[model samples]
Target: MSFGTEMENKDFKSTFSGYSKVEVDQFIAKMMVEFNSLSRENNNLKKDNESNQEKINYYMTLEKTMQNSMEIAQKTLKFSQNQAEKAKAHADKEADHIILKAKEKAKAILDHTNEKNELLKNEYDKYYNEFETFKIRVANFIEVQKNVFSTSPEDLELSPLDLTSFEEYVLKNIADSSEEVDDDELTLPELFDDEIDHNEDAQEHDDNLVKG
Candidate 1:
């Protein structure tokens, strides 16, 4: 009886030990599954971080490019403004030069006109003086002819005088006188001889008429 009891106790202890080993193996398998799940999640988080960093770098590059473009635009605008100002200054100078030239031309024209007017006035004055001198000379010639004819004696008859014959004789005498008398060399006695000879002939002709 004692041997059988000891054998039964040993058999019970062996069965319990076998169940503990199986439980420990199952626990180890569950822990391994949990560890693998955690490792996969960590790898996925690292990939997401890399992708976010690449996006931030791209945005930073775009910002730098835009800043350079803005700087270039500002420089171009300043250059255009400078060119405009230079062109305006040059145009103003050209306009002033043209105005000065026009003024000079106008002054020259006015001076020329004034000179011409003065020349014309002087010419008119000279012509008027010459005309007045001619008129005075004509009047003096008529007066001298009248005085010489009036002082002549009426009885010194050369012919029965018609108007035509008298005019012919007077014209002939005028022509002969012009040839013989030089005004600068003529003496006063020569001028009186013609009147004295005519009066003596008139007195002699009257004495003969009274006797007839």
Candidate 2:
């Protein structure tokens, strides 16, 4: 704002009691020209500083925005990770539940199978015992019949009875010739006549067959 070193080097002529006016006016005019130049430069520098401060403020605001974005991104990523972990845990739990249910179902199926097998075995045993008992009884009956109807081989040949007609023909013939006597029932006149009629009819059927 003040003059340059020229003002300090240049001296004014002394008048009666003060400096010369002409010289002072000339130096003052030159200092005003330089001061005006410095003033303009100072104003430009101030404008440049203000512009730089505005740019710095804008960059600081952008940094804040970027910092906020990063924080939000991190938070979102953390939230997603937590949700994924929960999903995995839930899936594992479901898997365990399914496995447990399957195991229980398998056990139930096995138990049912074992029970059915046991019941089948019991039924088989019961039927086998019944069949064995039936076989024993049939064997005893056959033995009894064998003992009661036993005859010598010669007698069997002598009396070669036809088994097809044995009940109706051979028994009557054998009884007629037997030594054992049970004459009470045979003495009944009505039954004896029925028997005689039956024998007559059988003899007539045999005669017709022979004629044919």
Candidate 3:
């Protein structure tokens, strides 16, 4: 019989030389004590095993959670990198536009300065040419007037003192009559057949103008 069935049945075979009844009963009692101790130990071992299994399951769950957190962190880092790249690109584009605008502004300013300088140079050349023409016209007029007076016929007769006073009056009137003359509006004398020299008169007039 199985050990468990034998223990429960407690039936013993009797013979003419069987063991003592009290001794057998005592042995059975001792065996039952040992079996009961083993049963309690087995139950404690089962409880320990169950506790170990529960710990293993909790550790598995924690590991899975840690893995998920790592994945999330990686994804966040990638997203941030993408955003940084985009922001940098935008900043670069804006900087290029600003640089281009500054270049255009500088070019415009340079072109305007060049144009203004050209206009000033042209005006200076024009004024110099007009002054030269005015000087030539004045010299020609003085030469013609000198020649006409030197060759003129003398018809009027008067006292020497009266003639002197009349000449002075005429010179004063001619000197004062043409103040603020415009060269552009002046009517030049007709050209003579030959060139006339008025270098001395021109030099004297220029000196007088400078002194005034």
Candidate 4:
């Protein structure tokens, strides 16, 4: 039977043979108080367990969220590194290309300068040769004139053909060596012409003497 029914139906044979009613009643009351206290404790323990489970679930979810955030951060870092490497490579390539272009330009400038120098040297040589030739011709003309002036008047009258030949030689040398000179100090050609005029005047004087 239930504890309540047992408590209610508990009988006594008589006052002398059975237990005292007051003592039994006090013991049953004490047991009922202990059972109620134990029940309250068990209910409190169940509530605590549920609260702890909820806290555990919240912490687990937070951990999962943190893990996902870490993954994203790592991906971002890797992507940034890759982009930096690409940028550096591109910069290096552009720098190399610029350097190569600068070298090529420098080489072209040097080549053109060398070619211009060669042309200037050739022109200088040509002018030098012409100047030397002009000086030689002038000297030859001067020598011929000197020889004509040294001859006697009688010799000139007798060898008129030799005088003509000397005159022709001077004219031919001057004509062959004539060139435009860009100097004011050189007066050989003009002096040679004056000498030729003087020789012609002397020849006319000798002719007048012969006729007289």
Candidate 5:
């Protein structure tokens, strides 16, 4: 209860030897004022303590929340790092696979090219050998003509029987040699053309001698 209300209800009994009422009342009044002031101050201090306690409680809750958030953030960071590593490993594996496939494809292409080159080489050798054989045959035919043409026209007697034998042998040999070669098979060399031109000139000279 307030000191003012308590003092109003208090009753002081007067006696013959009791202290003076006026002085005692004045002292009690001063003490009541000081007590009321101290009570008000104590109430205000209680209010301040309650407010400070509330602030401390809020800060504690905020700190706990921050700790939880930090934990979550760290976990998220670790998870992201793990995912990145996995992705990098997968990408590296894919790259290696691509490189391996490319190398295999390149090797296959090289092998095929080598095989094609070998076939072409074989074809060229076959054609070259055929060309050489053809040259030899042409040389032999030219040698036969040279042997026949070496005789002077004066030395060739014009007997009917001898003329028939000479014509039959020369014509038969020429026709057989001509039939052996087909124009479509092989391309004649420049040397063949030159040799053929030379033979044609010799044959023309021999015809002139026969006519004379």
Candidate 6:
């Protein structure tokens, strides 16, 4: 039918035509050798394909691992940045709070100082006013005393010289008398009782004579 079939039929005819046994045996050996060589070559090609597939699989796995590692690194970097931002914001808020507290305390201290200064100033003014009043009263009293002394007669029953000396003597006596009175516990009214009694007696005597 075909060339291959025709060749196979011819080969069969030749085999049956009583060829020599040595020649037939040699032909079978040559065919076996060719079959064994083709089978070894096919096995070698199959082994080479399997090795190449294993290398491709290994390289693909390595690529996937590198991609996963990159993703993890990116996520970590983003988280770190967020944490840093939060920390900075918190620090800024705390710093503002501290500054506000300091300002309030400083204001309170200044207010207290100002109040104390005002109080001290008021007390100084009050004391100064009282001192001025006392000075004025003392000066007026001294001026009145000077006028009285200047208007008094020179040769009256109490001479000027005597009055001056007597005033000093009386002042000294009064100081001494005050010291004695403090120790004696004497009252002012009781000290003048004898002089008042003598005056009443003289008046009563005159009234009796006038009535007679």
Q: Which prediction has more favorable lDDT, 2 or 3?
A: 2
Clashing pairs in 6: none
Error of 6 at 196 (Å): 37
Task: Extract clashing residue pairs from model 5.
Answer: none
Cα lDDT of candidate 1 equals 0.59
For residues 34-118, write the lDDT of model 4, one tens digit per residue: 7667767877988998898898898999999999999999999999999999999999999999999999999999998898678
Better model by TM-score: candidate 4 vs candidate 5? 5
lDDT of 3 by residue, 69-140 (tens): 999999999999999999999999999999999999999999998997786678557656655655665554
Residue 133 lDDT in candidate 4: 62
Q: What would the per-residue lDDT of candidate 1 be over residues 92-112, giving only the tens digit for each residue? A: 999999999999999999998
Writing each residue's lDDT as its tens digit, candidate 6 over 121-193 gives: 7855755664465455445435544654565554233665665654443334443533322234323344345
- For this target, which candidate reaches the highest TM-score against the unseen true structure? 5
For model 3, the stretches where C-alpha displacement exceeds 4 angstroms are 1-28, 139-212
Worst 10 residues of 3 by lDDT: 186-195
Q: Which candidate, 3 or 6, would have the higher lDDT against the true structure?
A: 3
TM-score per candidate, in order? 0.48, 0.58, 0.58, 0.58, 0.61, 0.53
Give RMSD to native, each candidate.
22.5, 17.1, 11.3, 15.1, 12.1, 20.3
> Could you tell me the lDDT of residue 66 within candidate 3?
90
The models' CA-based lDDT, in order, is 0.59, 0.65, 0.64, 0.69, 0.72, 0.62
- Predicted candidate 5 versus true structure: per-residue lDDT over 126-195, tens digit per residue: 6566657657667656765675577655455444357555554454444456654433323234336755
Higher TM-score: candidate 1 or 3?
3
Residue 100 in model 1: lDDT: 94
Per-residue lDDT tens digits for candidate 2, residues 64-128, read: 99999999999999999999999999999999999999999999999998997796688567656
Candidate 1 ranges with C-alpha deviation above 4 Å: 1-45, 132-212
The top-ranked prediction according to lDDT is 5
TM-score of 1: 0.48
Candidates sorted by lDDT, best first: 5, 4, 2, 3, 6, 1
In terms of lDDT, the poorest run of 10 residues in model 5 is 182-191
